[model samples]
Target: MALCDIGLIGLGTMGSALSLNIAEKGFDIAVWNRRTKVTHAFKAEAGELADKIIATETYEELIAALKSPRAIILMVPAGGPVDDQIAQLRPLLDPEDMIIDAGNANFHNTRTRAASGEPFIGIGVSGGEDGARHGPSIMGGGPKESWDSVAHILEAISAKYEGQPCATWMGPDGAGHFVKAVHNGIEYADMQMIAEVYGIMRDGMGMDAAAIGGVFEAWNKGPLQSYLIEISGEVAKAIDPKTGGAMLDAIVDAAGQKGTGRWTAIEAQHLAAPVPAIEAAVAARNLSSRRDARALGEELFGAAPKHLPHETLSIDTLEQALIAGKILCYAQGFVMLSAASEEFQWSLPLPAIAEVWREGCIIRSAMLNDMSEALTEDPERNLMFAPYFSDHLKKNHGALRQVVAQAALHGLAAPALLSGLSYFDTMRTARGTANMIQGQRDFFGRHSFVHIDGSEGQHGPWAD
Candidate 1:
């Protein structure tokens, strides 16, 4: 048997799609799965592509099939499974051999695993099943030399935006997954803001799903155009076959999460990064999960008072508000990324990151292209302070403020949107109320407050 260029373990949907994609790129692949049946099934499914894929029933066989300085990609579950696979493979591999974890493992864990004297790359692979089969955005982080060894294969299989592959070596030790977590965090905020807008249309304006779907469809063609927005329109328009009603109405209200967004929020808190929009989105998902509590609250308080009448709300205003909120959410995510880069000494390529996100990922949007350009122009400043986005917020902030106020008055839960508006408002404020917080902290906890004139820390004597 001819030696394969790379070996892949795990035959899950993502794993299979990625393997097929790699093979289609003309690289011979050796594949193994925990279950022999799965490996065989995948080989059968490969059809004509099977010639390029070597299915191995054992780890030793898989290892033997790969060439010297072997590259093996693991598509197992995050956490224990990833560690388990690495442990199993380490004993059979040489120092120069590489192990790439392509799942959504936490970045800290990636760092720990890499520090174990193993040549490992924790890569972030985004875009869903279809994207895995065709092309997906890839962000890799490990030793620069290790990354270079497999860079050609990764770049070849990644999605392209105007001939530039949506793949890049982010930074050493877990930067890729860290960026991926922030990506998901921004995704949470994006989806939540879209849902909030749909809520306003459905409840505040008394519009049906079809009408709201049309609104989202229109938004998809404008500044708000994105995969999430486009999907929201499709989801809203879906009809239930059994009930002949809107599919969204038939679906459950509860939202499910896989922890990346939560991780992003926790990391933001640890880094002292203000990511209220992402936090609010994660909180909203948690709130949604407590359906029983919500029901009880509704019974206790009676129905929420509806203040924003259907005739009073404007669809145009809602669109503008969503655009502003999205901008704020992206700003928060990018700011968090900047903080993480500084804290970790990663020197993350923010412009390249934005460029990678412009094509294949869930967050892909025209705005990302603009973001790439903005960051390229001023790599040091926060995204909110970028000239293009600052002007964007300046133009659309009124709509955001109005929408937030309307949601509050009407008893709607638009937490993400509200947080976005607040984040934007706070960022632009030269004199915030932090001094009061500092004073209270100093009085209660002896955490001294610094003066504005670069003076020494001072404490007040409070009279009881």
Candidate 2:
């Protein structure tokens, strides 16, 4: 029997799809699952691609089936399961054989694993099951040699934007996962901003699911066009089979998360990076999960959300506002990435990050294509300041301000939008209220303050 080109353990949803993707790309793959039946079932269901798959019942067989100096991808859950798999595989494999952890791992864990002197690499894979089976953006981080060893296969199977594959080496150690975390953070903000717009349509405009879906469908053709917006339209337009009503209407309002967004917010705080849009998105999701609290609060406060006056806002204005919010959210995410790049010494490629995101990922959008060019011109500058994006903001932020203000007036909770507007406002202000904060801190904690006139650490007069 020919040795498999690569091996994948944990034949879960992503694993099964990715294995098929590998096999479909003409690479032989050895696969294993904890349960013997799952492994066989995957091979059995693989159709013609089953010819390229070697299903193994045991770790020994899984390891033996791969070529010498083998690389195996672990699709297990992040944290302990990944560590457990690595520990088990370490003894069975040679020092040169690499283990690739491909789950939504915490970057810190990836860093620790890479530093353990083992042949390990961590890659962040984005896109859901369908993308896994066809193509998904792949962000790789580890020793350059480890990434180089597998780059061909990764690029071969990854999603592409205008023929450029969306798989590339991020940097050493946990850079891939760090970029992925930021990707997810932006995804959170993107989704929240969309939801907020949807809420305005649903509650404020008195539009039903179909009408709201129509609005999203129209927006999909414009600057806001993206996977999330297109899918939102599809979701809104879908009809319930069990009931005659809209499928989206039947769904619960609460959203579920897998902790990646929360991780992004936590990591941003650690880096002293201001990602308020992402932070607000995470907070909104947390708040949404508290259905009972929200309901009780609604009852106590007498249901603050009411239908807006007919002339209050337009779908066109909402689209422009969403455009502005998206720019701000992505700007904050890139700044956070820049901060993390410095703190981690990774020298991450900001333009490549945007390039990869232009296709496969949830946040993929036409806007990112412009962003790639803008960042290539100057990666150090904040994205909002980039001429292309700055031009867009100048055209759109008025609509954003109006939407945020109206949302507030109507008692709508547009946290992510509000945060973006606040961040944008703060960024444009050269001298602000922070001097008052500095004085207060000096008065209470003697932290001292610096004056604009080239003075260093001076005590406040309040100390007397």
Candidate 3:
């Protein structure tokens, strides 16, 4: 049997989508899942191309079907299950056999896993359900030779967003997962920012879901246009089917996280980098999950502070705030990614990464295209100094500040958006209060000052 170039071990949403991509590309695909029914489900769902995908009943059969020196892609859940699957495969496969873990496994775990006897690559995939079905942003970190062997297939399957391939090599040994972890950390912040927009629009500005959705649709046509905003519009318009209502009962208020976002925050803490927006987003999700605490707080503290009843907010104004908040959220995310790249020595191409996210990924945006262009032209260019971003922040920081103040006045939590904006403001403002301490240190510790003598290095007294 010709060695099967593609084998997928999971048939979940991501795995299935990837399998389709592979099969569509004319690669012979052998798919197996731990749960037998998932394979059956895949068979049922996969029309016409079903015969090309062989469902395996046993691990040995699956391995045998792939032939020698097999290249298998594991799209299973991260952590222990991945370990277990690898253990089973190691004994059955040869040294040249390759495995790619495409799930969002922890980078530390991925590094440790790669250190095992068998050769494997940790790949991080983004662009959630839709990205899976169509294409997704793929990041891989492993042996250069291993990456080379699979690069062609990876590119074929990955989603092309913003005129760049969604798949890229993020250097060796866990870098891909690390970058993806940061991607997800940014994703959390982005989601929270959208939620804040909704809250402010509904509770503060009194815009209906359709109106909010309409604003988002228009925002999609501009520089702030993005996949997230487009989806937000659809979600805003989604109504409860049963009750003929605007509320979606299918989605619970309690959001359960898969721990990657928390891991990103934890990693940031370890790196001695501030990820306030991401951290705040994670905290907000946790707070949402803690229903008992919320109820208790309400009971113990009595009625919450009141804001003006929902009033109609202009679509134009809402769109502007959305744009500003989106920029801030991305800015913070990129900063965190930059910090991580520096700390981990990944040497990631920021602009290239941004380009991939512009099309197929959930966070795909016109802003990312600009980001991609800026960073591609100069890899070392920090986003804070990017001309477009700087100009946008300069023009809209005032509006963001006002929105944040108004949200706070109404007791709405907008930590991600607000923190990101604050970060941007701090980065840009030359004489802002944020750097007062640094200036004070220059005056006291370094004895460097804007001197009255009008010379290069003149002194200024701190106690004066």
What TM-score against the true fold does each predicted structure earn?
A: 0.97, 0.99, 0.88
- Model 2 per-residue lDDT tens digits across residues 204-323: 889999999999999999899899999999999999998989998899889999999999999999999999999999999999899999899988989978888997999989999999
lDDT scores in order: 0.91, 0.94, 0.77
Ranking by lDDT: 2, 1, 3
Misplaced by over 4 Å in model 1 are 305-307
When 2 and 3 are scored with lDDT, the better candidate is 2
> Tens-digit lDDT track for model 1 on 1-464?
58999999988989999999999999999999999999999999898899999999999999999999999999999999998998899999988899999999999999999898778999999998888889999999999998999999999999999999999999999999999999999999999999989888877777899988999899899999899999999999999998999999998889999999999999999999999999999999999999999999999997664647645668888988988999889988888989999999999999999999988899998799989888899877888788898888888889999988988988878999999888887887899999999889988988887888777777768613
Clashing pairs in 3: 136-159, 161-359, 205-311
Query: Which of 1 and 2 is ahead in lDDT?
Result: 2
Candidate 2 — worst ten consecutive residues by lDDT sum?
454-463
Reference-based lDDT, residue 299, model 3: 94
Q: Which model scores highest in TM-score?
A: 2
Best by lDDT: 2
**What is candidate 3's lDDT per residue for 429-460, written digit by digit as tens?**
67666346646767668756554345655444
After superposing candidate 2 on the true structure, give the runs of residues whose Cα lies further than 4 Å from its correct spot: none
